[model samples]
Target: MTPSQNFFSDIHSIISQARQNAVRSVNFERVVMYWKIGQRIFEEEQNGEQRAEYGSFLIKTLAEALEPEFGTGFSARQLERFRQFYRTFPIASALRTEFSWTHYKLMLSIDNEDKRAFYEAESIHNLWNARELERQINSQLYERLLLSNDKKAVLAVAKKERLPEKAEHIIKDPMVLEFLGLKQESNYYEQDLESAIISHLQEFLLELGNGFAFVARQKRIHLDGDDFFIDLVFYNRLLQCFVLIEIKTHKLTHQDMGQLQMYVNYYDRVEKADFEKPTIGILLCADKNNTVVKFSLPEDNKQIIASKYELYLPSEKQLLEELEREINKEKD
Candidate 1:
């Protein structure tokens, strides 16, 4: 490239970065302004002996006086949100500058404290903007992770208190694929699903969880005279292992488990480095019987996991019901 072209490129990059920094500064200032407003409103409410009635009256009157001058940002509904925001995150020092006001607004709707904290930490860690964070929350990412893992461990990993030590802690079951834009009613082959995932690889990785870097597609391994292909391969830095995923258009069976196990064994013995952890094999199937999965693998097995994949996102009620059923089945 000519020196002139290089110079222009450098200047463009500088301007772009500067604009981004300016926007971030403005966004953080707005977050701080809202927090201060909420703090003042909360303090005023505490001063009144009848907190609930007085607080409602205070916000109503305050909005009436302020909205006309400052625009709709000071509306009664917004003021109430501000009040709730301050109450939700009481410590000013805990507020992360990386998070915009919109991020907090979305988080405020979450009733569970642990769930809220998980989203907060994940957003900061992943640099997720408002839209992505909203998508994950709506998709019920936290509840999905909680399905087969302990709550404290899940929170600990999400909050970066510790890295994930187990595949189940990070690999979500019944993976949501609404972003893939596939018709739920239509039948699809394994290759079609694989192609869709490749096309929407960024969203796929986000759905796959943290630290996953794509390695290969249709990875081929030669076993003696025959050749077999693995559907997808990913390396997860957080788990420090290779995650081999085999897509199945049908319900999972013992044969499917054995196939994944063989691929996992090959990866562990041949591909895995001495310092790296064991490879984890996931059977991403249309349906899976937990009882069949349980008996298919050895009692002490932790490397093989069967996860059901959905072409579309499931409602929170449906996910909760599925979790409840699984819990009861385990109890049996």
Candidate 2:
């Protein structure tokens, strides 16, 4: 590059850094202010003998007095959220500056403490914006993952201190693909799902979980005189392995599991580097029978998984039913 171009690029890079730094500073200050506000409100609430009565109208009175001077940001509802925020995160040091107040508010709505903490840590680790954090929570990402793991395991992921060591650690069954914009009645092919994922690859990766990067589509593997094509290939930095996904628009079958197993074996034997982990193969299909999946793979299988894919989030009732079923199955 020319010296002039180099000079311009340097200036632009510095400007970008400066802008991001300024935004971070502003967000940090904003969060600190909210924490202080919450602290003051709590202290005030406990100051008098009739604390219960004082607390009843404390927020409304504060909102009325503050909103007139400070603006609509201090609405009663928002003040209550601020109060709840302080109650939930009693320690000021626990609040992360990378997230905006919006992120905290969304997390505070969660009734489960473990779930809330997990989401908070994950938001920071993944650098998810408020919208992304909200989307993940609303999609029941925690509950879905819990279906595959125990409480300890679920919390460990949010901590980001533990990385995925096995296939189950990285795989989420009944993966939600609502972002693909496919209708329920539409007769879509596996290729259609593949194309949609490619188009919305960023959102797809978020749904896939952390540390996934698109590698290839229809990755070709030559066997003797024939060529075989794998549907989608992704490299997960966290797992240090390649994720080979095979899209099936029908219920998962043992044949599908066998085919994916062959692909995984081929990649592990031929494609993986000496330092990399074994390639993980996923067969994502429209439906999955737990019995079928259990019987299809070896008792100690970890390199391959068969999971269901959903074009939409299941309704709350449907999700509850599914969860109960999973619980019962575990008991059995």
Candidate 3:
């Protein structure tokens, strides 16, 4: 490399490292400050004769006084959040530096303590940003993982002790494909859905869960003088594998599974590096027949997967029913 290139590369590396450290330090200090502020507010309120009135007035008064002098970040609502932050995580050392105040604010909105803790730990382990954290929480990632895996296994995976394997780790049921903007029961072409996904690619990536980086759409693979185009291709950093996705507008069939398998095999043999993990194939169809999927793939199949996708978010009732079914299947 040229000297200028080497200098720029080193500078970039230093800047990146410095930025990461700065973020961690700032978040850690801010959380510590908020916890102390909350504790102080709580103690003062307890000691005050008019506890209820005092608690209500204190934040408002503080915000009114501080906003004029200190500028932004001292709103009444935010002060209340700081107070709650202290209550939620009383220990300063327990606060995770991976998440910012915004992440904690979202977490505090969750009512269930156990669920809150799970998200918190998972966010820290996954290094998710505030938006990513919010998406996972909103999607009920913890509940879904619990439905699919044992409680112990779920906790372990959340803690990053045992990493999740296969498509199940990354795929969310009733996927929030609001990006597609296609109405359910409306006649839509596969090309239209693909176009929508491309248009709102960022949202689709977020919905696809963490670690997925978009590689291509309609990626062509050549084999034996024949060419086949895969609907989508993504690389999962966490799984260290290339994921080949096939979009189907109708119910999944054995032929769809076989096509995906063929694409996966081609990628594994030709495109994927020797050091990379096995390629994973997914058939994202409108519907899937579990029996067909099971019998279609080999008995010892480990690399290929098939899943159904939805154009819209499912109701909580539907999610719960699916969870129940998964639990029953696991038991059986």
Candidate 4:
């Protein structure tokens, strides 16, 4: 590539940066304005405690006045959202300027305070757009983490207050891969799914969870003149470990677990340096039976995981049901 000092390229880069910066400035102002509107409404509500109906009336009157002068952005519903936004983020100085009002609006739809705050912080850290934020929420990223970690601690990790220590803390079960666009049919080969994952590597990394950097696809290994391959290998910087992942197009079995364990052992013995954490192995399969997996690995095993993978994103209702089942099972 030519040096950026080349005339046309330099002009292009300068104009692009200027436009991007301008958009960010406008977005920051818009977000702050909404925050202030919420603050104003909150203050008014606080002062009118005597009138039970004042809150509703205040919003209606404000919307009526503002919508005509401004636009639909000030609709009563939108104003109420602004009010809730202020309530959620009481500290204006702490608001994340990296996100636009659109991102905050989507985040506000999450009713849980910790979950909302976690998503907000993660978006700023990950540089996710509104769509990506919505996707992570819809996919229950928080809930998935909550499965392997304490609620408070998981929220802390999401907020960057603390880092994950183990592979379990960052891995997602039944990983969502709707971006691959593969049909839900059972005829696809393992290589096909591996190829799709490689093709959509960025999306795959996002679904794989945080701090994951892809190492290789179908990483080859040889032992005693025989060859073997691992479908995917990722390194999690947060955990400081090699995550060796084997993809199975069908349900996972003991043989699969054994194979992955061997790969994990290989990496721990040969690939990783002395200062790095022990390698972790994951069997990413279409299906997993908990009883079989439990019996397959040693009772105290900490380095092997068998997680199911999904070809499509589940609907909200379906995700809720699955989450409830997981919660109940965990309780048991």
Better of 2 and 3 by TM-score: 2
Model 3 Cα displacement at 234 (Å)?
Answer: 1.6
TM-score of each: 0.98, 0.94, 0.73, 0.93
**Candidate 1 all-Cα RMSD:** 1.3
Q: What is the C-alpha RMSD of each candidate to the true structure, in Å?
A: 1.3, 1.9, 5.0, 2.3
For model 2, the run of ten residues with the poorest summed lDDT: 164-173
Candidate whose lDDT is highest: 1
Cα lDDT of model 1 by residue, 188-304, tens digit: 899999999999999999999999999999999999999999999999998999999999999999999999999999999999999999999999999988889999999999999
Determine which window of 10 residues in candidate 4 has minimal summed lDDT: 142-151
So what's the TM-score on candidate 2? 0.94
Clashing pairs in 1: none
- Model 2 RMSD, rounded to 1 decimal: 1.9
Candidate numbers sorted by lDDT from highest down: 1, 2, 4, 3
For candidate 3, the clash count comes to 0
Using TM-score, rank the candidates from best to worst. 1, 2, 4, 3
Clashing residue pairs in candidate 4 are none
Model 3 residue runs over 4 Å out of place are 1-34, 41-84, 96-101, 112-114, 121-132
Cα miss at 271, model 3 (Å)? 2.7
lDDT of 3 by residue, 1-332 (tens): 45798898999999999998997898878877888889888887788788889899988888898889877787888889888888888887787767788888999998887678778777776678898887676666666655545666666556677676766765655466755778988988888888988899988887776688999989987778998899999999878899888889899899988888988988888999988899988777888777788899999898777666766656656777888987776578
lDDT of each: 0.93, 0.87, 0.79, 0.86
Task: Name the regions of candidate 2 deviating beyond 4 angstroms.
Answer: 1-3
Put down candidate 4 lDDT per residue, 1-332, tens digits, no spaces. Answer: 67556788889999999999999999989999999999999899888866558999999999999998899989999999999989988898988767888898898888887888788878877889988998998887887666566778877777788787667777887788889999988589889999999999999888887889998888898989999988889998889899998888888899999999999999998899999999999888999888799999998899999888877777767766777887787678
